[model samples]
Target: MGKPISGSAADNSDVSFGLTLMAIAVLIAPLIDIFSKLAIATIPSGQITAIRFTLQVLFILPVVALRGALFDLTWKKTALHALRGVLLVATMLSFITTLKVMEVADAIAIFFVEPIILTILGSIFLKETIGWRRYTACGVGFFGAMLVVQPSMQEVGLIALLPIVSAFTLAVFLLVTRLVAQSEDPWSMQFHAGIWGALFSAALLYFGEGTGSDVFDPVVPDALSLVYVLGVGVAATISGVLGVYAYRAAPASVLAPLQYLEIVSATLFGWLVFNDLPDALKWLGISIIITSGLYIIWREHRLNKTAGTAPVSPAI
Candidate 1:
């Protein structure tokens, strides 16, 4: 209704801070893949998933307590949180399993499809208006993912498809998160998700034990394995916290595209740590995925602007 304040000075600070934090979160996020890749050499991917959640709870517990919201949850919120936890397990298990054989950058590139999947699901479940353009972007994005998957599947067999599963599961997790996020404290939401994830994953590890399954069988962590698993938890905790605060500081449209930076981080880490690199075709696929994803973000921002609304920041 009124003229907006000038953004050339004061308004830039919060947005700038948010961008910086998001960049840091992006840069560090691949460390989770690095650790999972390392630890999965000896430990099962499911085991790594379990350790990550357990460590996340430990890492986040004090913060939740300090915020005086550790006990602030209702049955409904708890149930939703539990659902988030299950989806998180599915997401992480799929991701870590892929990390067992796939390059971190390639795996991350495929996972970028999550945003596109989210757009589709939002149209379906939220009954949000969607135009054909966004739908086209989603289709193109999947084509890019197929490019990445083509070579990966040839090299790694069906293991390459796991990131798609991860993406879909995470998309569902974010949907569940959307249901209760406005009514819950962010820290408590994270803490409760961690609690439920730890419980469910551990239970899975229990039931899946001794089935002779590489994905589900228990492998007790040795001393060095302990460090690797802790690394997974620590990286996840730090990136998660930074992301929460980043959204608090800036709008989703401004910060969403920056998430692609994780691919860069993952590629670099994969090279430095594991000597993995994407081939020329894989590079092309990665570029397409990033470009298509950015187009979707820009399209949504434009639509939200035309409608006089803000883009909803995702909590996943």
Candidate 2:
């Protein structure tokens, strides 16, 4: 008979599978930006955010039912899910708003600061230790994000700051996600979050529609626009599921750097769909941001190796 797999071997296998899932998530995530960009050509960002989450709830409900996970819900868990959903709505609203006025690649490049933000938040809120090297890398990553934002600021004005806000909210979202991840299945969490996000966005749409705020105004979508909205929903659902499971199976440090892959996908999609390309300076900033993020991941891995310790939760 073949020998049983060792515990460490099983763990390694899970990590490999998780990383594979993360890569898939990263690849598909850019589609949300692409579809949102297309949809918002006519649809308002608030409406788009509402439809995306409503569809996510519809898409994931059956999966949660099939998994027999609905009974796992508690008031506390439900409330936590709602709070996470609010943060996610903020993250999406900010990002999609940026996409409305900026190139997809540039907006995404600025949002890639999430990892750096995550590092700092992890150290503060999660009480994780960070050495000077990782701290310095975070600063470098922020500079790179600034580089991506500078040239476009003249045209987009304050809209360029939206992605930075997105990064901050996303970092907080992931931190909360880590806290609840162990108790809730990914499907259930996704379902509850979708419901809460849809409701929150609908409220925003209701309150802001006639308020002369262009970002919050509602617009009716034509048939083709409906297709774009549904595409954003589907892409977001897939990305959320994959991301939740990826973080569950692997350390955040292992998966955080891989998040950079989305920028490449975003750049490609932007060029193909919108004829948008980053300038040389923007490219330089992107390269630096990518480098800094990867260096932090590498430093964490080395430290963990030396200390013989596993990484902390939610690597971002």
Candidate 3:
């Protein structure tokens, strides 16, 4: 949400400060889920997703206007963005469903499998080369995912599969993001993402109504629900912006590891808010996923170092 820092010492200080701020921003995500769950007590999931992105688009309108990035969209990039928008909406809806049904920690741990999915897709679609070390990293990351998901457990619900699917969808979104980033300005890409995501979700809200389905509870929207919706919008926006800034400020190697913090934070939040403590198997799964994620990062670092090239794109 703040301006990205530049070359001055003071700016470097600001960058350091922003790193901490980004971690706090990451925490806001789980808090958003906490709020959304509370809101879902009175609002439908479709309506909530729609409202979340509606407010996000509204929030971005002024910036898109001020920067004059509104007209930057062209037909060439339109299709790609539209595809990404569809995937993004799917991830949002599915992740929210998982958030409603599972502990935030478990959901996020499963979602951390994104890097593995992304790397695999990279080699297949993007033709990015993969090495043994990176393959090993992928293995470790999936192991960690298993630790969190613990599919074999008696209490584990089949619905938990949604988060893994959501993670794969998100990985596709990231792959598209990387492809688009080379040709499109970040603001323009973000603008398209927000606008299209909102439109897609809005259509779902419309159809839900058409089917005589309940959309909103018609209860008086209290301050808490309003706060949660507003927070979801604002927090999501902050994460997007700060994520861009973090990449600019430091190498992906430095910032990529910081993402693991989200898992720890979510685990803590899950325990504190939902009393969803992880058993030994879940703990093992979480450990495996985290290790795999880090291993991928490390493998990327090693490859880049040996090849004498810069770091690879950091996947979310």
* Clash totals, every prediction: 0, 1, 7
Model 3 residue runs over 4 Å out of place are: 1-18, 151-153, 210-223, 305-316
Residue-wise lDDT of candidate 1 within 1-316, one digit each (tens)? 9777776655688889988988898888889889888999999988888888888888888888999999998888878999999988888889889888889999999988998888888889988788999899899999999999999999999989999998998888887877887788988988898888889989988999999889889977799988998888888877888898888888888888888888888899999999999999999999999898888889889877311111111222
Q: Write the per-residue lDDT of candidate 3 for residues 1-316, one digit (tens) a residue.
A: 9886556877667668656655655655566666566666666666777777787677777787898888787787888888877887787777676666677777777877877887888889978889887887787777677666665334557767877788788778877877788877777777777778778888887666646444422234677878877777776776666666666665556566667777777778778877887778887887887777777777777777311111111111
TM-score of 3: 0.85
Worst 10 residues of 3 by lDDT: 307-316
* Ranking of candidates on TM-score, top first: 1, 2, 3
Worst 10 residues of 1 by lDDT: 306-315
Report every candidate's CA lDDT: 0.84, 0.82, 0.69
Can you write out model 2's per-residue Cα lDDT over 86-188, one digit (the tens) per residue? 9988988888888889999998888877878988998999888999998999999999999999998987898999999988988888789778877888778
How does each model score on TM-score?
0.93, 0.89, 0.85
* Model 1: lDDT to the true structure: 0.84
For model 3, the local distance difference test gives: 0.69
> Top model by lDDT, which number?
1
